[model samples]
Target: MSLDSTLHEALTALNQGRYKTVLKVAKSGMKRYKSHPAFPNFAGIALSSQGKHRDAAGYFKKALGLDPTFHDARRNLAQALILLQQSDTALTLLNRLLEGAPKDPDGWYLKGQALLNCGQPRAAADAATRSLELNTRQPRALNLRGVARNMLGDEAEAIADFQTALTLNPNDVEALVNISLPLARQTRHAEALEAAERAVHLAPTHLNARLRLAMQLLESGDQDGARDQFQTILGQAPGHAQAIEQLAALNAAAANADLEPIARRALKTAPRQSSDAARLHFALARMARQAGEQEKFASHLTQANGALAHIMPFDSDGDSQQFESLRTRFNAGADQVQAPAPSGPTPIYVLGLPRSGTTLTETLLGAHPNVCPLGERAVPGVLLAPFLENDIAFDTAACAQFVARDQERLPALPDGIRFYIDKMPENYRLIGALLTAYPHARIVHMCRDPRDVALSMWQAHFSGKALSYTYDLAAMAHRFNLYAGLMAHWHSVFPGQILDVQYEDLVTDVDGQSRRLADHIGLKWVEDMAHPERSTGPVLTLSANQVRQPVHSRSVGSWKPYETMLTPFISGLDPNLWPGVQQG
Candidate 1:
């Protein structure tokens, strides 16, 4: 065949999603038209579509070698490198490409992907934005920007991007999966579940789609469905890192020793510094802990934290500086608020540090017939953004607007629900604005032993960048110190408006604490409030499985087991925040 016909055939096959046909055409075309770079580039694309990134990289390199000016081939090579987890090398190539062709939208998008792979979400977001500015019609660029935005905790903007991408391509599985979590976090469980379900339907065997569907199922309180999804993934790919880890976590307390071997085997092949290895190692650690293998647990836990830290590094100094700024501004009443909304469901703000009993407290409140627990909604931060950016006071009119916006943002409330709970742990940062905006808002400050909180956070696997401080011992301690200082400031400023609930005290004396919580939140204490295990509210936190069971003292002093190993975390914590625990 002539070169023109050969190139046309390969390009047509590629555009039609006939990857296998594209490979066949490319192979035949390359044999006759060896001088053409397009043949090798098409072959590389086919290989990449078939999940053969290493093979794709070889073809792409050959294409670039045949024609040094083949920008398409260079971009494809970088994309393959990204898929192969060689992000640093990919970034280098993408940088060189962008420098030469600064107006290339594809180059910017690939650079964003490379930056995202390198854990530079902020930079990735900027690169993605540049691509979109150059070409607004690219759904992939919009989706890429959404992923980066989600990582940077810009859920509202991320969702907007995802929605726009879906408008462009309704069957975009990546956008569907990416948007689900933020929607779920916003308490729009139905929408989240719909997106996840559609992704899985569109790509049944896609690992990420299945994993996301399972997570959405878990978030929507469909444990059985979630378990089925995880089991399906494991059945298809036994060595799937996230599937093994999640399934193990779902059944950890039941002594799911069956998964320990799979996780152990997967860990051997996963890269030492990758998130996959961290998850597998954490799974094994959980299994070891369950089997009473203390030393084994400690060893795996240490390795997991080490691996995770490589991917999720926290800027302790930067975080501290920001905290200092927030404390100073809030202390000076920089964003003072107006009175609470006159008529609406009373807002209950459950704020604290991660793993500080926020979930358990929310569970207890959710059990109340009149309280609707909007599980960990990110609305407070969104509502506080305007005032936080400016040095303006939120007067009564502004407060009314704030309340109106919050109510509109919230999911449709069920009939007879009088108190809507926002149990985001980080809501502690917005206490001042939250109180001012919602005058009748009740604050429940959940406090736990700093040592235990630090340990729990270290062992936990968070989804996004919001909880990245938990990946390191020192970072966790630093976050705790900042959180403590901020909470102290809020307590002094809003005296008697906040109710302090110690986790240990609550777990030990469930009845008394339940009464205190109900009264403080303006609810009548009932027997149902004591039975949180029976409450079917959404449990999207890391403690999802643990919270479904009866409240127990098992996790109260969990830090004691690794007391020696947690010296770094303990040493970094404030002495005054140690509670009843004796610090050596």
Candidate 2:
């Protein structure tokens, strides 16, 4: 008395607009298979129509378990699990089914849906693409693929897919909502808003469309528009955590109009966290150095250094080898250069490890009317390529010739843009070659607490930066010490050209330290040097957040709380670099 055939026929009928016969035949067939697998599933599907998800899920799961290879049972089980908000398990099962039918267009389409719910979009895009390759007419696959592609950062492909999905099915809310995000990513605010508004018009209660629109409005400085959108969401869900958290943070930020007073208070108070303590000590040290308080500056610098040394212990020998290995591949000696400096804006490179106030320094210098701080550039390394005698990294003659030919594509020397800042921290290694390229080009090497730098690197997420060494504390320590030893090498190689500005001094006395920097570059300063970010606009780096804000002395000695986690790294740290840390 199996009802498998009847239920299969009913789904076929249902999918083909035979609703009356589907319900009647499905009901009649259900009575015949009292306890059959298809009987329970068909019954569950009917029950789901009446909003009986709890009962439907039990039947679906039982049917799926009884017939493991049953495609309909598995598909229905996934749908049921989705209804119960168990998307992770549903996605896993759906993926398994998809793998079995790898070339099945419909299977790939369903797999994409499961992937979207699981927030595994990068994978979802591949599945969706497979679906389209098998059958280009799959509208659901097109729409889901568009969503997946958007998540994968392929904005152009995503827009086309979404448009095609709309052509196939004009009322596709998923396609409409998915299209707006890529537009936003492209910074096309008005177009994104227009698309999102159309989505809202089509589906008045669509939450995602409203949220995306709200974010764009907020970014465009339409605060009232953003407020209205957020308020509408809160009206539907009073305890929405994301909207609530954003609202709370926004309100809190509004309370503190300026960062200076808070930062000053933080500077006076003893830091509770290791990170906080490090920043304060560094700030105090910098201030002491600037006020010509030699002993106090030395003491504070020692303290700041000691605080950092505890986090990343040095590996002198290993780092020396690693540093040499990189140099053999990248460094350019003056002997490698045969031609004169390529005509262009005089390049000024600012080099240091992360969290060493590179941004602060660049902003201060870039604030001068004559200088343009491009933040970080691949061009310096590009320009220095021909001079670099790294036989291991390139076919030396070919690489040198390639640079000679394409050197003109570099930034045209704009009027008054005399000194260009290339503040890529790793450029410290390239200072030798850079000096070889343009003999008169200035270089600034920023010095900070090695341990603090490592600690900061661990706390931050640098997107896709390839310094895999930063994750391990001991590795970070080794890298920092290695970097320090290299700086020592640069000092001997290029005497009187490189200026070492300790970060601790800069924070303690911004005015005085800025003067030293100005003197090095032979430039006069303006009153705006007091707040570099406020004056040095056109930032194009991760430091944008820290630089957009005013000067703050809250980052020194910031690694103290994580001392326990940092101990492993500290043991290997260079004792000389952070004497205060070793003392602790």
How big is the positional error of residue 538 in model 2, measured in Å on the Cα after superposition? 11
lDDT per residue (tens digit) for residues 60-156 in model 2: 7767766777777777777777776677888887877776766777777777777777666767888788888999987788888887765554566
Cα deviation of 538, candidate 1, in Å: 2.0
Candidate 1 regions exceeding 4 Å error are: 5-36, 54-71, 74-78, 81-203, 220-222, 252-255, 332-343, 382-408, 576-580
| Candidate 1's TM-score | 0.83
lDDT of 1 at 128: 96
Per-residue error (Å), model 1, residue 573:
2.6
Question: Per-residue lDDT for 388-430 in model 1, tens only?
Answer: 6665566778778777767766666789989888888898888
TM-score of each: 0.83, 0.51
lDDT of 2: 0.66
Q: Weakest 10 consecutive residues, lDDT, candidate 2?
A: 254-263
Clashes of 1: 1
